[model samples]
Target: MLGAGLAHAATPEAYDPWPGLVQDIFKSRPIHDGSGVIAIEMPYRAEDAAIVPVTLRSKLAPDDGRRMLSITIVIDQNPAPMAARFELGPDANVMEISTRVRVNNYTDVHAVAELSDGQLYVAKTYVKASGGCSAPAARNADEARGRLGQMRYRQFKRPGAAGGAREAQIMIGHPNNSGLQMDQITQLYIPAFFVNELRLWQDDSLLLAIEGGISLSEDPNIRFTYASNGAKRFRAEAKDTGGHTFRNEWKIDDPGM
Candidate 1:
């Protein structure tokens, strides 16, 4: 949310936005020793500047026989610092997740994970897209306004009844205006409006939650996996910084069954 009297400035082109970000993270959750248990997956050259996919994973030894506790994703140059955060429940085995995000400029994106034992792990990836914020919205401004807060859900079925796990993808129709883009006709900067949080659920149970920022592209897409034994439905709810919310649901009736 924009604070009073805080004017938006021209975007900057910098390589290392992590120092400040890391400092802030440390201030929030101080950790003494952290190593390389985190991993980031992204392309060196994004084929489409509009929707660059990013995946994050972590590998950690059991901490006192307990699993990792939390993971946070940060995009340095976004108007708001935090991009997404996932909390792992005891039954949660979220080794990886994929999503689309906006890259304001060339910068380093960090994935930091915290284990139950209080140890920190970090991984970094460099994304080359620049000035994505100033890029024109995917659809006409009027059209986007009409479809704001709309969302869609899809579930991918693996072969065979015993295929094991199920994967689902959620897409939201949000302009994600970064406050830096100018109206093609009016030539005035569009006000910033973007998703702030997303929650994924399975049959009334929490699967994962993501916190977003202006760094996420317009109409953001997220993919996550979970085990399905044939009878549970998937649900997702998302909220933007402007306080708007959207929800969607999908049922799983395995065709193979």
Candidate 2:
């Protein structure tokens, strides 16, 4: 998360932020050729700035049976550039993911995946989206605050079931108002309120912890992966920029989650 320290690839206004943002964020972890391994799905023109959907899929070959280490999502033009990060477990094998994020302006969204072998693969798409992080409040203050940190989860079959790399989808409820947003009625800037972190676990084992920012869409959604050992126990912990905290846990008898 490089604090929008972007100076596009070109120049002042013409500068594309991808090059600088990527360099700053990855630092020593340089990128290599991602020819056949990674794919990113995003619309050329995003219909909504606040809820732009982005999907990611991987093509891990049969020979590369190692579990994926992690996935990092980056929006190159937001105030805080790094949107979220997903860390996977050893038994994990799937990598299909879909999430919603904000784009302050027309920018590139990058999905970088790290394999167990420590190799990184990247996929990126330029989205024609704008004004997401600073858009006006989608909901009133009371309504947004009441639902902050609330989360929803839905499970899907892992790779073995249907031969696809998908496990579950988690949606978190939060205003994520950048504090730069203005209230329609009051015409005053909404105070900075957003979900800053999400920690997920299965039974006693930690799965992934996503550090988020204003770049995360309101009611952020993520499709993630986890191993179904014996008990399908899941837990999520979320915190907001406003200092409010929330937690939820569920146990599923079925191994699907």
Candidate 3:
């Protein structure tokens, strides 16, 4: 029940509705054929366009020694195609990430990965969703403010894996109201309020930082990895469009043991 896509349109001459959007972000570099190494998953038909879930996974060989460095997500044909960018740290085992975004129309979502050596791989998913950017508000402002900035983390360790790192998931509490959603009573488009930025850390060191926008889901959920096998303090800090900041931490006594 996951939808995935690979660009196998015969040649680069294939017409893209938004021609320069991809090249605009990654100038000069050609998007070579990519498969197996990069994977993307999403619902073929999004139930709610405003908060559609998307997951990207990078299959890397432990011997290859090239850790994932960062990921850039582009939603072609959107008002702002550049949806989000994730900058990861050295031990940032961000090989796989799960988050949500707003898909304004039926278009392709590209997940571009930048490996340690600077090579980039791309995976595309064609999603059929619309009106996410102009949908009605799911909740009122007063109710949303009460649960803003709340976050928590959960760690999961796989058995018999390469063991280079362990995986964990973090969920933040925020209405992420895109302001595009209309308030029924007031009949007004609520001002866009969303998580704008995030930084994940292992103790004092920055593990990764993410830039978010209205495209992100109502409550942003992130799954990533970090060096494991011992105790580590995982911290997450985030800021919202409303000028509010959130800080929280998780203590892993003995991870991936």
Candidate 4:
């Protein structure tokens, strides 16, 4: 009966604790109205229930008026809830980012962008992937054990000749089990484990650092753009909820102007 109850549980309420979660991160009062400063991009229906891509863009000004300094993504019903937080660098032109996250059930995912002026802009979208994290590991537990913290990276050069900005994609292998999941054979709950942080660096300079909780998908994939001089190298280091760290690096060829 207990197993049946777990299998047949109703999806949790959508956007629960969203208001408080936004307020806690912004560290100031809330914006009663978020009309024009925020935009959220996500698919209406995910192609694969396991990997849903999301992007958050902030349209705030960059002067003393309102310069965006941070953004947060939250999936309401995940085990740890808070999905990812990104802190922007001074010259960071990264108003957009793409990442995959896990959805325990049908829920609303929120993107909150914060400006230097201490105001928060908010946007949200609903996703339909349910029980994604709780799904069994794609491979056997024993086979997945030794490869847990592995990381991979791929860099793509631009079309022209002179080196300029470039795009890179990083993927880290981790189960990101939401702890609510149970082993199919053993029927025991898998402990909660997920990626905690991912930092992107170019020539030892920080570009973006992401802090995540249990909402990240198994083997999270992140893609973002960065300014690149000719012959520069990029690196990413990630840490999981279980305190395991993995790192990967890539080099960009001469990018045409």
Best by lDDT: 3
1-257 per-residue lDDT for model 1 (tens digits): 36533444444554565777777865545543334466788887777755678887655544436466777778777666577777754554566678887676666777888877676677778888776667788889889888888888887775552226566778888898878888989999988898888887777767777777777788888876655534457778889878887888877666223
- TM-scores for candidates 1 onward, in order: 0.81, 0.84, 0.84, 0.80
Runs of candidate 1 exceeding 4 Å displacement: 1-15, 28-36, 60-64, 159-163, 229-231, 255-257
Residue-by-residue lDDT tens digits, candidate 3, 1-257: 12323445433664575448756888847664446557888898999998888887777766777767888888886776877898877755666778888899988888888876768788888999998877765656676667788888887866665656678888887887776777788787778888889998877777779998777778788887666525468888999877888999988777544
Give all candidate RMSDs, comma-separated. 8.4, 6.6, 6.9, 6.7
Clashing pairs in 4: 160-256, 161-256, 162-255, 162-256, 162-257, 163-255
Stretch of 10 with least lDDT, candidate 1: 3-12
- Give the clash count for each candidate: 1, 4, 3, 6
Q: Score candidate 4 by TM-score against the native.
A: 0.80
Assess the local accuracy of residue 70 in candidate 3 as a C-alpha lDDT between 0 and 100.
80
lDDT of 3 at 245: 83
> Ten residues in a row with the worst lDDT in model 2?
1-10
Candidate 4 per-residue lDDT, tens place, 43-150, comes to: 777776566788776565444366667778877765556788888655545655788776766777778777776776678888877777777767677767767878
In angstroms, give how far residue 81 of model 3 lies from its true place.
1.8
lDDT of 2 at 255: 60
Q: How far is candidate 1 from the true structure (C-alpha RMSD, Å)?
A: 8.4
Task: Please list the C-alpha lDDT of all candidates, in the order they appear.
Answer: 0.73, 0.75, 0.78, 0.72
